[model samples]
Structure formats: C-alpha cells, structure tokens
Target: MPVLDKFNMVSQGAAGNLCWACVGWSVARYYDNRAGVPPRWSTLCEYVMKAADFLDGISPESTRCCDGERLLDPDCNQSRILPDAFRVSSNQGSVRERALSFQEIKTEIDAGRPVGVEVESSSAGSRAIAIYGYDDSESQKVMVGDPAPDAPDGALIPYDELCFGYRHSDATWNHSYLTVP
Candidate 1:
C-alpha cells in the first residue's frame, strides 16, 4: 500500500468555521505525495478555503459549514477556480449506500489516494476529515488527518469509532465522502 509522504497535520487555528481544512489538507497531501515534495499546509489551506466558496457559492460563516455535495460536484468549475497544480479527478458517494465502507476506504489508501469523510464532532459539531491509511492488525484502525485545533495529526482511530462518527445521524451531512482517483 502507498503511504502519504511529507504529510503533516495542521491546526485550523482561529478559523473555527473552516472545518474543511481537513479536506484541503488531504487534497494537498495527495498532490504533494504525487509530486514528491514537502507539504505546504498553510498555502493549501488558503486554496481550499477559496475553492470551497467557489464550489459552495457562499463564504463560510461561523454558524455554517461547507456543503459536501458542492465539493464533490463533478461538473463544477474546479478547473477554472483551482490552480492547475491543485486540480484533481475525484469520485464521491453516500455512506448510506456503502460507498464509505472499510473496504472502499482501504482501496483508496492502497491506491495512494486520500478519502474525505463528513462526520459528527462533539467538539465542533459537524466536521470533515481525511482518511489516509488503514491498519488491519488485531486492533483495526484508520489513520486520519484532522484539522480541529485540539486534534492530533495522523491519529490512528479505531475503525468502529470512525464509523460511528461518519454515520452519526446528527451530522450536517451524514452521508457523503469524497475520494481521490
């Protein structure tokens, strides 16, 4: 399986509304790994914030979160808005359809791709995170890159715990995950 190199987790800092920072970091890490370069976490975060507004057609507010549907829109103007260097081909689906299953997540990881998942967060309400690795040993877990200020980078969360968060009924988008191709 391919593991992301030169990847580092970053804090969302004072921008509490930018939960999509995880998504940005995941996409940035994917491109950085492909280019075999060191991570540019802050720069990528800037681009991600702009891209989110373009995709969602609204600037993120303190009380609102970015929409997953808009981010995964295949026909959106990603090419026009995102720098050519940051552009990527992707696929997405709903958790209710088994699209975010453990096998599917592992498949992406094995292919050197990161998966962006929407999950419920007690600390920040609804949140997004990137899943970059899977461990199937006695204690199965998925490696995650989270942007919450208090979250640690490369946290190896149990698969079941991730599932609970991803499938949490109270989350803003209880169904979506965007996958890199």
Candidate 2:
C-alpha cells in the first residue's frame, strides 16, 4: 500500500467530495512531466467543478452527484485537473472503461502514476478516492487517500473488495477502479 511514494497527495479536509476529485487531479498533474509547479488544491477543484458545470464554484462538504463529463472527457488536459486519465476506444460505458485493466492499474502505480477511483456512497451520493499503492500478492489491498475529513490519507481496502464494491450491482459501492494514462 505504500507505492505512492512520489505523489503529491492532498487531503480534502472540510472541502467535501468534490475536493477529493481535485486531489486526484492534482496527483495526476503532479506526475505529468509537462506540468510546472502544482496548483493549490482549491484551484484544482474549482477548475474541475467548472468543467463539470458546477458554476457556483463551491465545495458543499456533503453528498451530491457530479456530472461525469469532467472526469471522462478525453479532451481534458490531464496536466491541469482532478479528472481521470482513461484510454479511449470505440465502445460503450464500462466496456470502454475496462481497457485500463487491473494489471494496468498496477503498472501505473509501478510507474509513479496515481489512480483515480469513483465509488458509490449512500450518504454522499458519489465519492472519489486517490489510489497511491497496492499490495498485489500478499493481501491484495490498495492504499487510498480518502478526502473525507474523518478519513486518513493512506487507508487500506482489499483489492478484490474494492473492485467488487465498484460494480453497480454491489449494494455498498457502485463503481470502483483506477483510470490510468
């Protein structure tokens, strides 16, 4: 779970779920070779929310659904935002998304790239996690940065459990997986 040694992980604190997504973006940009100095967390979050059409520029610190546009937009400059890095192909929905497989997720981690995850939450509607490391063999666990104020930066979850929870059929979690570049 300690694989993310080089990522510039940030906590959302009281900023809310949207802020978590920004943390993911910031991590991605931090790894982008073209990016300059990392921007403030708020700046990254605001930019993402704006792209998602959240015009008010606010982090509600509460559960809410976000427009998927910002996270999935292939045209988005990965060097600047909390949006995910997905490999695009001609397919639909999860099928297209699955191109970045679990092994690829591990490869990204090995290469110092942080992964972005989207998980369902009953209280918060939708939530995001920044994945920095994974125990691929011994425990099959992942190290994640939870943006919630009460959660610590490096929390652990079973790799299979997290992946299973991500499925829409899972009662506790709806979606899970790292979108890699």
Candidate 3:
C-alpha cells in the first residue's frame, strides 16, 4: 500500500467540532512536506500558538493555558491557548480549540502561519477555521485569509446558519458553507 500523503487521524475524538483539527493537521502536513522538518503534534500545536503571538512579541510560556478557564484566569491572564487544551485524552484523538475572534487570530495568517479557532453560526456541526490571510476590511467587502488550500468547505463562512460541534452538520454536508450577513 502506498503511504498516505496526509497524516491519518488514527482515531476521531468525541468533541464539539473537529474541522479545526483537520485545519491543524493541514498546517502540520504543509510543514512536513515543504519545510523539510515538522513539529510533533505537541510541538506543532505550540508553534502555531507562538506564530499567533509573534504579532505582539509574546512567548509560549507567557500565553500557555491548559484550558479556557485557565486562559481567562486573572493570574494567568493568558492571551492564547494550547492544542492540549482541546485534547480530551492523551489516549484519544486531539481535541479542538475554542472559537476566537478574527482580530485575535489575524497576525498568524498574516505571517503565513496556521491557527485554529471556533467560529459561531446557526448551522449545525463543529467548525474551526485555519486563518490564512485577511483582506483589508476598509475595502467594504470581507475577504478570507485562506491558508489551507484543501479545506473541506471554501473559506469565509458568514454567520447566521453556522453552528459548531464535531457533528453539528454531517461532515460531508458541512462542507457546503451557508453564507449570510
């Protein structure tokens, strides 16, 4: 058998949404194939977070948070989260991260980095976006910063019918993004 071109997700986890996981793996694969070196799941996840922080010159140690609660803790006061935060179990598949605002994830894409975040919508299913690039909103039209060339659904989903959760929409059906204002 031919070695699969993409990393096979040995197991799928029971979580809110996994599209983000696919997005994460997409970035991992890119580095694996193009960068000539890649980070492990744990390290790759961190690199993604660091890329996000590069915008503000923050370090992983400064932004690391195990969970949303910790990330929001006054003491931790973290601005970022780890893929581990989404991991339901070390034995199971990777967990997906929470949805962050567009502004929160802009820089990573601007720098050619991939980051995951949940996006809210009325549609059913878990959803995550791999932020790739952003269009100047000043143009009066929204443009996507699509990093994953093969994302299941075309990037730039508008809110309204978008709902997130691993099975919110059947994986196949979910790819048909419903756009709204």
Candidate 4:
C-alpha cells in the first residue's frame, strides 16, 4: 500500500521485473532520509524525479556539494553539511559483497530486471549510480544504464567493466530500504 512496500514487492520479483528506476529512487530516498545522503538522480531532470527531489533537492549549495562524485566522505569535508553515507565505505569494497555480483546482475538482466550500481572510483570521478537496466548476455559488450531523460552523458559501459569501481562485486542496491517517512 505504501511506496516503500511497493518498492519492496518489486525488489522481490524474479530478476526480469526488478524496475530499477523505482529501486533507485527508493534507495536514494532511504539514504537521504536515514543518513542524509544526497540524491544521485540526474540534475538535468530533477523535477521528473519527484520522489528523489523530495528526499534531497538541488540547490546552489547542495548542487556544488552533493554531486554523487563528491559525496563519498562521511565527514563530507568538502560539504559544510555532511551526508551520512558519503564516507561510509572509505575505499573499502562496497558493503554489497554479501550479495549481488556479475552472475547475479546477469540473472537480473536475463529476466529483464533492473540493477543498482553503487560504485565509487576516482577514475569514475567518484560517484555512485543506480543502473536502470542491463544487457549482460551480449557477447562482447554488456549495456547498463538508466532511462532518465536528463542523465549524464557516456553512461553505458561494458558489463565486465562495471564491477571494478565498486567496493563489492555482489552489492546490488535495494530501494525498499530507502523510503522517506
């Protein structure tokens, strides 16, 4: 009956029906609420991501401060108003290694399910994102991305390449845990 409940239901689905966008919005919402983590949704289409906006909206200060790449420090040294999840991992493998991996991402992909990518790499400009969907079965290249109209450019990357930036190979973000009360 609630958005979080709906998100939980969708997350529980067999891999093909995961609905990653909802998951992304929900998880980001959770982090924003619980840990004061900033929103990772596209700035270009902030209005469209209403739920995420509600969790962490863009403003002049938050904009320069909260960008996904910059939020990695839990202390948020750069940002005067620090977010909780920012420095939670600190170069360690993502907390996600307990579950979610290439094989798991593949299962979700084969089923047309959505997956969330929680990667943090200086090479990647230091940011985390929610992969909308992926095509891991492709022979040479696997496609992973979100469909948000205003997402950043150059979003897609080879599936094999996606795992390195993260702290864990098996971490998949779950949004139901992210609802804003």
Candidate 5:
C-alpha cells in the first residue's frame, strides 16, 4: 500500500472537465480495486457526475451543465453516492472549514486509499487532487494525482500549504473536499 500507484492516473482532457466529480469517482474506484483500463475521460467524467446526482435531485444527464472549474452548486454530496462497491462518505462538516486532519488523511493513504482534496487553482477555479501518499522526511508533503497536472507523477503540495489551500471562500460553500472511504 506504499504510495499506491495502481490507481488510474488521469488528466482532465477537455476544457469543461469536472475535476471535483472526476476525482470523487477516481478515489472510489481505486478503493474498490477497480483500477483497470478506465473509460474515456469524458465518459468517466459523466459517470462521476451522474453518481453524484442524488444530492440535488437532478437527472444524470443534467450534470452535463456542470462544466465550470468550480464544483456544482451545493457541491456533490459524497454521502449520497452509492458506489458499486465501497460505502462512500465525507467528513461531516461544511465546506468552509477544515474537514479532515492530516492523520486522518494519512491513515487512509496508509490503507492504500486515495483521498480527494480541493485546492485553489491558479488557472481557473479550485481543482481536485487524489492524494496517494505522504512524505514526512525533511519536509512534509503528500504525493497527489492532479488532474490538471502540466506533466507526470502529478505534483506534491506541502502539508501545511495543502491544509491552508483546502480552506476556500467563494460564492459557493467555503470548504469542499471528498474523502476516500
């Protein structure tokens, strides 16, 4: 389970990819051990959005409208999604505050679970990343699978910086993140 690399590494391939929901399903699939050849990027994006439809009582097809960089209004309720295998849920709290502790995140990663996190993006709105492992040597950082990566292996965010960035304040909810179950 050390730095679980079997999880599918994906890049948001289109201008309107839903990073929030994409990472949600990605972590879920990874936890379920279903990291085979993934569906097309667009198809997987749509699937994740549909899986999150129970939150807003919306049709699966209607999620296509959520094409912006930010998460959909009210955000995708991670608890509402009934993943084919795992029982998915989020850290209970509003998106405006910190939802998980570093140890909580590390515990999941130690179990070979990938957790989803939302961070402010320099390009568009906030972006989502799938965190796989932690490095607590000289500097503390987490190995992440950033869908918006400019290159491979994604990138690493300093643990403190990641905690700060996860606290977001926008027109929508303040704190928004999805955790691996």
Candidate 6:
C-alpha cells in the first residue's frame, strides 16, 4: 500500500503555477504507477494550463502562482480536465472535495492513489502537493511529493501542521483536495 517509492518528485520550475504543476505531477504519478506509462510533468502541466486558458479565456500567464480559489473554479478545475488529459472514461473521473479528513486521505493512500492537496506555507504562501503515504507509528505524518524547487522527494510532514495550515488559509478552497478514482 505504500506508494511513495513508486513516485518521482518533479519540480514545477517556471513551467506553470504550483497548482497546475502539482496536478500534472500527481496525475502523472498515478498513471505512471498504474499503467507503467511515464508522462512528462512539463507536458501535463502545459496541457492543464492550456485547457484552463481555452475554457476560461484567461491567459496561461495569469495562472502562474494561482491560489486555490482559481483552481477550483468550474472552468479550471482539475476534475474537469483530468478525463480529457488522460483520456479516461467519464465514469472513472477525478474529484475535488473540501475539508477532507486525515482518515479520508489515509484511505486513498492505502488504495495506492496519490492525492493532490493545497496547503498554506507560512513562507511560501499556498501551494499544491501530492500525498503518497502515511505514517502513524508515533506522531501522524504523511509522505508528500512536493513540487517546490528545493523540496526533496518523499518528505514526511506532520498531518496536524498540514491540516492547520489548510484550515487557516484565506482561500475558500483552502482545505480542498483532488482525487482520481
């Protein structure tokens, strides 16, 4: 059930906003592990950003460093784009939900699915990260694949700290997460 080892953390770089880059990386990891087809993170990121631009008439540049609110919008939602991006059947769709509990996240990880989440960082503002595993031996922590340039792959972060930051963020979509089912 542990999937952290299956994933490779890819940095977002200047390709797009953290939101789209994380989405791209998460989705790419999902397919890479599930199908053994490795998709480029930059290609997936561009696909997502271009889809947003086409649907919402917003320039891709405007999407750079976007907050979660913009990401959750109907036109820009990853749930809406994932099917097309990967050409999956409509029934096997992605979901974006608010305030998912730690247990919910654990359940998904146990199922071997990586989750995309928006967490507020005090110094870095809001960014999206992919959750791949969890540890509850002592203090509960989740294994995260962050898309930040300097972030190492498979970093363990305290679950409580992530929850607190997500809950306290100003964005309405603060505690929201995306899952492909």
Global lDDT of model 6: 0.57
Decoy 6 TM-score against native: 0.62
Q: Which has the greatest lDDT? A: 6
Cα lDDT tens digits for candidate 3, 42-108:
5324433444444345565675523521222232222222243223111122333333344533544
Q: What's the CA error at residue 170 for candidate 2, in Å?
A: 6.2
Query: Would you list the clashing residue pairs of candidate 1?
Result: none
Model 2 whole-model lDDT (C-alpha atoms):
0.50
Q: Which ten residues in a row have the lowest lDDT in candidate 4?
A: 1-10
Tens-digit lDDT string for candidate 4 (1-181): 0011111211211222113333344444444444455545443123123323343453434443234433322222221111222222111112343225556555544443333444434442223344334443444233433322333322555554555433345433322111122
Error of 5 at 17 (Å): 4.5
Q: What lDDT does the true structure give each of the candidates? A: 0.55, 0.50, 0.35, 0.33, 0.52, 0.57
Cα distance off (Å), candidate 4, residue 129: 2.1
Record all residue pairs in model 2 with backbone atoms less than 3 Å apart, i.e. clashing: 25-82, 63-124, 166-175, 166-176
Report the error of model 5 at residue 25, Å: 2.3
Model 1 stretches with alpha carbons more than 4 Å out: 36-45, 56-99, 121-124, 165-173
Tell me the lDDT of model 6 at 84.
35
Residue 90, candidate 4: Cα error in Å is 26
Off-target runs (Cα >4 Å) in candidate 4 are: 1-23, 26-95, 110-112, 123-125, 136-140, 146-156, 165-181
lDDT of 2 by residue, 78-106 (tens): 23223332211100112223224557668
For each candidate in turn, the TM-score is 0.62, 0.56, 0.35, 0.34, 0.58, 0.62
Taking all chains together, the TM-score of candidate 1 against the true structure is 0.62
Q: Give the lowest summed-lDDT range of ten residues in model 5.
A: 79-88
lDDT of 6 at 141: 83
Give the Å shift of residue 26 in candidate 3: 0.6
lDDT of 6 at 40: 39
